[model samples]
Target: MPAPSILSPRDGSNIDPRSLLSSIGEVVYSWDIHSDGLQWGPNAGDVLGRIPEAALNRGLAFAGLVEPGSGRSRYDAIVSSGGHDHGDGVVYRTRYAADLAGRKMWIEDAGRWFAGADGRPATARGVLRLERQVRDGELGAAGNDVCDRTALIERLEQTLGEHLPAERIIVVLIAAIDELTRLNDDFGHEATDEIITEVQDRLRSVMRRRDHLIRYSSNRFAILLTGCPQNQVEMAARRFSKAVGQTAIETGRGIALVSLRIGAAVAPEFSTQAGALIAGAENALAGAKAGASDTAVIARRRQGRETRADEPSLDVQAVAALNERRVRLALQPIVDAGTRQVAFQEALLRVGHGMDGPFFATAELIPLLERRGLVRLFDHRVLELATEFLAADPRLTLSINVSPRSLIDPEWLDAFLGCTRAAPGMSERLIVEVTETATIADPARMAGILKQIKDRGARIAIDDFGAGHTSLRHLRAFPIDILKLDGAFTQNLRRSTDDRFYVRTLIELARHLAVDTVAEWVDDELQATMLCDWGVTYLQGHLVGRAELPQRGDASALLHATG
Candidate 1:
C-alpha cells in the first residue's frame, strides 16, 4: 500500500526488501540511523501478533525478546562495537508479544548492520520468523495445526534418549480441561474446538521457547520442559495450572470459564522411561481431578493405590486414635493351589477409632502413617498382635508384614526378636514378609536383617516380588523362604502373553532359588488355575477368599483377646 514498506536501499538501487525477506522468512525490519527508530514491512504486525509500530516505540526491542543464552544478544553485541561495522549477520531467538496469550511462537532473527550515507553505522536490517528447526515437529508452513500425541511422544522419547546422562532435570506436565465433557455436550464440537484453541494459546504463552506443547488427547494437553531445575518443578506445575484455569474464554454463545487439572512429573525422579513418565503424570492428573477444583499435583513414585501424602484433607485425629491402640486386624488366606486349604494367612492392618468406626483402606492408611512418622510404632503394634495371634494357634501359620524401616530401627528390632523368643513355637508359625520395593537400598544390610530374622527361626517372605528393579542375583542373595509375585503380573494373565511369560520366568527362578512362589492378586478361577499349572506354591487374592477376622475363642482371636 505504501511502497510495500520496503527499506531504503543504500546503493541507490531499489532492492525490494520483501524479496530478501521471503528468502529468510516473515517480517523484515530495519533500524533507522538518523531517527534511531525501528521499522518493519507490511506483514510484521500479523507475524508478531502485535502492532509493529507500537511494539517498537514502546521499547519492546528485538534484542529484549532474545532468551538469555539463546545465541548472541544482537543489541548488546552491536553496542559493544561502538557504532562501527559489526561484521557478519547474527542469529538469535525471541518470543512473540507478551500481551498475546499462547502466541509465544519463537522467532529466529538473523540481521546485519549496514552503513549510513555518511559512511557511519546507520541502519540494521534482517528477517525474523518462527524457527524452522524446532525439534517438536509441531510447526509447518501454516503454523496453525496442533501436534498429535503420538508424534509428541516420539519426539519426547527421542529427546530423552539423546539428552539423558547430562544430569539435567526435565519435567513432563499433563493437563486436562475441567468439565470438557459438559462443554462438548452443551456447546457442540465447534465451540469446544474454539475453547481448546484458546487453551492451547494460553498454554503456549506460559512456556519458554525450548518447552513443547502437544494436544495429547481429546481433553488433555501435554507440555514438556527440558533443563528445568529441580527446585522449580512445583513452581512450573503451578504456572501450568494457573495459565489455563485463571480466566474465561469469550465464546460466540457466552463466556466459558475453563479450568484445568495439572499433573507434573520430573524426569529421573519419577522414571526414565517416556511411557512411564507420561503414565505417572496422567495418574497424578487423575488424582488432581478426583480431589479439588483447579488442582495441580506432582507425580511421585507409585507406593500404593491412591497413596499420597498431599491429600487436601488428612484426618490427623484418626492417626492419634491409631496411636492410642484404635486398630483392627484382618487375615487373608494364602491357599495351596491343589488342596484349596489355607497354607498361611497374611495379617492385614486397618485403622479406626473403634471396631464400629470407619476403617481406612490399607493403601490409604499406610501412606498417612508413613508421612506422620507413625509407621515404626504402627509396625510394632501390628507385630505384637501378629505374635499373639500366632502364639494362640498350634496349627495356624501367620504371615505378618514388617516395614523395612523397622528393620533398621534397633529398638523395634530388639522388641521384635524378644517377642518371638518369648513365645513357644511362635517363630515356626510366624512368617515375616518384607515388601520387595521397600527402602532396602543397601542390599547387604537388608541381607543382614533377613539373616537375623531367619536366625530367630522365623521364615522371611519377600512381598510384592517382581514389582521393581530387584535383580535375580539380589533375590538369590536374600535368605528368602517365599516369593510373593506382584499382583501386576496377575492383572490380565489370561489375555496378556507378556505377563504370562514373565510369571513363568519368575516361577522358574523361584524354584531354582529354593523359594516357594506365591502368586498374589489371583482374582478369578481361570487365573488361579493358570497359576497352579505354572507350579505356584500358593495363590492369594479375593477369588480364593476375602480377608476374615477370627471369631472370639477361635485360634487367632483368643490370642488377640489375651493381648
Candidate 2:
C-alpha cells in the first residue's frame, strides 16, 4: 500500500498523487475483511503515531477505536453502497473519529472495495488522511453544531454541481440579530455568547437536514435553504425570525428579548454563483437592518430570461396576426360517454397559419398574455365569438376558458352582458372553464366571478382537477356545473393504481355535488372505456373526435344547419 503527500490541499484535488510511498500527510492500507488482517504503508506509523500499532494491525482493533456516530463505520459505507462494480470494486469515502494520544482527530478515509462471489465486500485498499483536530467543544463555535464559513461554501458548491433538473429553487439567507452590538456591550461576551447559542439552537430546530445554518460571524448566521421555492422565501424567513427571537432568552443577568433580521436571495434567479449569492444576501441584510424589520428582503438581480433584442418577438407577431383577422378557434368536441354524440365544443384559440402551422396556440400565447393583460382582452373577444356561434345555430354549445386575472378586469362584465344581450340564451349554451391553479391569485375573486356565471344560465367547469388540490367546499362555493378531470389523471390510468382510485373518488364526489364529469385526453379505447365504466358523463379527446377547424366558408353545414 502507498499514499501520496498532500501539500495543503484545502480542497480535494483529483490529480493528487495519493498512491505514492513518500506521502507526508496520508497513510495507505489494505484490509482483509474475513481474516481481520491489515497491511500499512511506510508512512502509516509516523503519520498515525497517536494510534498504537496493535490497534492499527487488526480490523477489529481499529473498528473498536473509532468514535460512535451515525457515520462512524467505513465497513457500512463499503457494504451498504448500491450496485456491482464488475470486479473493479466500489469506491467509498467516509469520515470517523478516533483517539490520537487521548485527543480526538477526524480522519477522511477513501477507498475501493472488492466483492467476493457472494457479492459482499471481502477486501479493500484505501488512503486515510487527517481531516482535522478536535478538542472538547471544538466541534462547533461555542459548543454548538453550527460550522464555519468553509462548510457553507463547500456545501453550496456541491448542491449547485449536483442539482436535479426538476429540483425546487435554492435560496440563501443571511441573518443577523437586531442591536447585537448594543446587547454585547451591555451583557458582555459570556452573556452574548449565550444569546448566540439560543439563536443557533432555534435556527437548527426549524431547519431540515438538507438545509444548513452556519455561524458566519460573531452575530450573523448564513442559512442555505436547499429546496425552498421562490414564493415561500418570505414566509420561511418570517418563520425563522419568530423561532429565533420570538420569546425572551434567559441569561445570567436577566431575561433578554432579541429580534432577528434576515435577507434572502434565490439561486439562478438572483444569482447562479455561490459567492454572488452570499453577497446578494448580505446586501439584502443591510437593507433589512436599515429598515429595522424582522421580515426578510429578497435581493433581485437581472434575470437571464430577459428577451433578447435580436430575437424576433412572438408577442409582436401574434398581435399583428390578431389585427390582420388571422385568428380562428379550433373547436374540440366533448361528447356524451354513453351515446358518443357531441355534448359541446371546447374552443381553443389559434393565431395565424404559417408554413410551420398556426403561429401559436392559446396555450403558448397565454403566459405572454397574462403578463400584458392581453388574456382578458382575448377572453372578451372569445366570449363575443362564442355568442355569435350560438346565435348562428340553435343547437350549438361552446366552452370558453377565462383567465383568473381576466375576472378582475373591469370590462369583463360589460363584454359578458353585451354577448348575452345580443343572443338570448347564450349563457345557457356557454360553459366557462377556469384552471384550478390560476384561482390561487385570488380565490374570493374567483368565487365572485363564478357566481356571476352560475347566476346567469352559464355553466362553470374547474379545469386541471387534482393539480390545485381544491376542497369540496370550494367546488360548492363556485357553484360548479362540471368537473373536467385533468388529462394527467387518466394518462397513467393503466399503470397507476393511485390515479385510478383518485379519479374514482373525484367522479363520486362530483356526482354527490350534482356536477357533470368530463374526462379530457381520451386518446384511446382503453381510456374511454375506463372512464365510461367509471360513470364519466362526458368525454373529450382525439379518440372521440379531433378538434376540427370550420372549413373555408361552410358555416351552415359545419353548424349542422341549412337554409
Candidate 3:
C-alpha cells in the first residue's frame, strides 16, 4: 500500500478528492480541501481509527477535534477575519477533544489562513498534534518548568490573609545552593536534584496546609507559617527539629543525612512586619546552626522588658560592672566527716545592685557570666579573692568551681596559675571543682586540663557526682583527686536501701583508688555518723561550719562552735 499525497489548490477542474483511513496497527488519516466541504484522502480511516469507507461516508467533522465552546470562538474569529489570506497568515490556538476508536484524547490545533483571487480570505489549513509529552532531551535545561506560578501566588495571598495580618506577615529568603554545590561536585547533578526533591517532599509533609512553602533557590526553601503566636513559635520549631532528625534521604550515589538548625522569631515579638520576621529568624537560625546539634534557638529582641531565654539580653552594663570589682565573694565551708574539722571552703561569687542585698552562690552567677562572655573575668577575680584569704589563714583550704569554657582557655589557666604563685604559699591549699556534666562533653580534653591543674599542687574534684549519667567509666578515666557525692545520694541513704548500697559501693571504690570522698548536705548528726561510718572523708552542710569570711582567730574555732 502507498501513502497518499497532499497537494496545494490549483486551476479549476473536478477537484477530485479521495478518502482513505485505516487502523492496521497505529491509526492514519488524510484530508483534502476544496471549494465546498473538505474531502478526505486515502488512509483517512487509519488516522481517524476507523474504516476507509466510513471516514469518506461521514466526512470528518473538524469541530469535533476542538473542546466545546473553545474552538467556536476561534472558528468565528477566523471566518470574520475574511476566511483566509495568502500573503497574510492567521494563527489560531485552541484546545479540543478527539474521538479515536470511541476513546477521547486532547488535541491542540494550529491553523494558517490563505487568501483567494478576490482579495478575500478563502481557506485555512492547519496541523493538529496531541499535547502528550515532550522528549527529555528536547525539554532542554529548563525541564518541564512545572511550577504552578499562579497557584503559588494565590496560595500565598490566601495564607497571609487568613493566618497573618498584613502588618505581621514576613517572607525570608535564604540561598543554600552553595551547600549543594559541593554535593553536586562530589556526586552529580542528578544526585543533587534527588536530594532537593526529597527535601521538598519532607518539608511539605511536615508543614501545615496553610503554610506557604516555596523552593526559592536550588537548595533553599522558604516557609511561612501564618497566624503563629509570638510565644508559641517554639512549637513550630520543634516540628522542624524532629523532621530533620527522622528523615534521611538516599541519592543512590551516596546517602545524605538530614540535619537542620532552626531560628524563629514571633511576629510582634521580634518584628511587626514579614520582612523583619524573616531577617530575625534567619539571624537566630544561623546562630543555632553555628552552635550544637539538635537545637532550635529563638531570636531575642531587646525592648525595655526583662529578657527571657527566648529573647536577646541587654546586660552589657551588668557584665562591665563585674570587671570593675563590683562583684563580691562569699565562702561556704566543707568539713571533715569523722574528725568534725573544717577541711575546705567553697568560694561563691555574688553580684549586687545597690541595695539589693547579697545574692546566693556561684552556680547562679556563672551562667549569667557565661552568657555575657564574662566567665573568665569573674573566675579570675574570685580566685584572687580566695588566694588572699588563704594566704592570711595558711591552714584553710579553699574550693572554687571552674566552667568548661574557662578550663579550655589557656589565658584563664595562665592567669590563675600566676595568681596562685603570687599568693604566699596558697597553691597547696586550693581545690579546683569541675562539674561531672560539663566534664563529659569532652572527656579527653577535660582529663588533660585536670592533669595540668593536679600537677600544680591543686586537688581536682568531680563536683555533683551521681547526679546524672556519670558512670564508673568516667571515674576510672579521669585523674580526679576527690569525689563530692551529690546531696541527693546522702539524702536517700536513710530511706532507700538501693541508695545505701550504691553509696557504700562508691565509697569502697573511691577508697581503693586512693581518691578522697566528700558527702554534701549532711544536715543532722545521724546522717553525719552514718556517712562517717561509710568512710566519707569530708562532710559539707549547715550541721558543720556555715560559709563565712575569715575572722581574727583560728578558722578551726568556727568548726568547733558548729559542732
Q: What is the model-wide C-alpha lDDT for candidate 3?
A: 0.55
Q: Assess candidate 1 and give its TM-score to the true structure.
A: 0.46
User: Residue 244 in candidate 1 has what lDDT?
Assistant: 74
Local distance difference test, each candidate:
0.64, 0.68, 0.55
lDDT of 1 by residue, 50-156 (tens): 53444554333544443332222334223212222322122111122122224434443434444432233445554455533333443332134434444667877
Which is the better candidate, 1 or 3, if ranked by TM-score? Answer: 1
Rank candidates by lDDT, best first.
2, 1, 3
Task: State the lDDT of candidate 2 residue by residue for 1-563, as single tens digits.
Answer: 11122222322222122222223345557777657777765556656775777678887677655554312255544543334534334555555666666767776565666554345566776656665676666444442454434456787777776663556578989887776545654775458778878888898899888887776434567888877888899999988999977799999877788888888988878777887887788767766765676689899875568767886676777667666667676677788888787878888776664533434634335566787767776777677667777777777788998887776776897678667766667789899898776655667787887788777788888886654336555666777889897664555465435456556656766666778999976767987887788788999866776656676333234444211
Give the winner by TM-score: 1 or 2: 1
What lDDT does candidate 2 reach at residue 351? 68
lDDT of 3 by residue, 1-563 (tens): 11122222221121211111011111111222223244332334434545234433432344433323112222322332222221323333333344455544444433444443333334444433344333334323322222222333454455555555556544332212223324554666567667766766676777777566665323444566666665556667667556654756788788876555566666555555555555566555545544543444666685565646774232454465565656655567687776676677787665544324343223233445686677877777777777776776676778888877789989878977787667635778899998777776788888888888877788999876653335555666788899997554565454435455555655665665679999876667877887787788888865775566434334444434544
Q: Give the TM-scores of the predictions, in the order they appear.
A: 0.46, 0.45, 0.43
Question: How does candidate 1 score on lDDT?
Answer: 0.64
Q: Give all candidate RMSDs, comma-separated.
A: 26.7, 28.7, 34.8
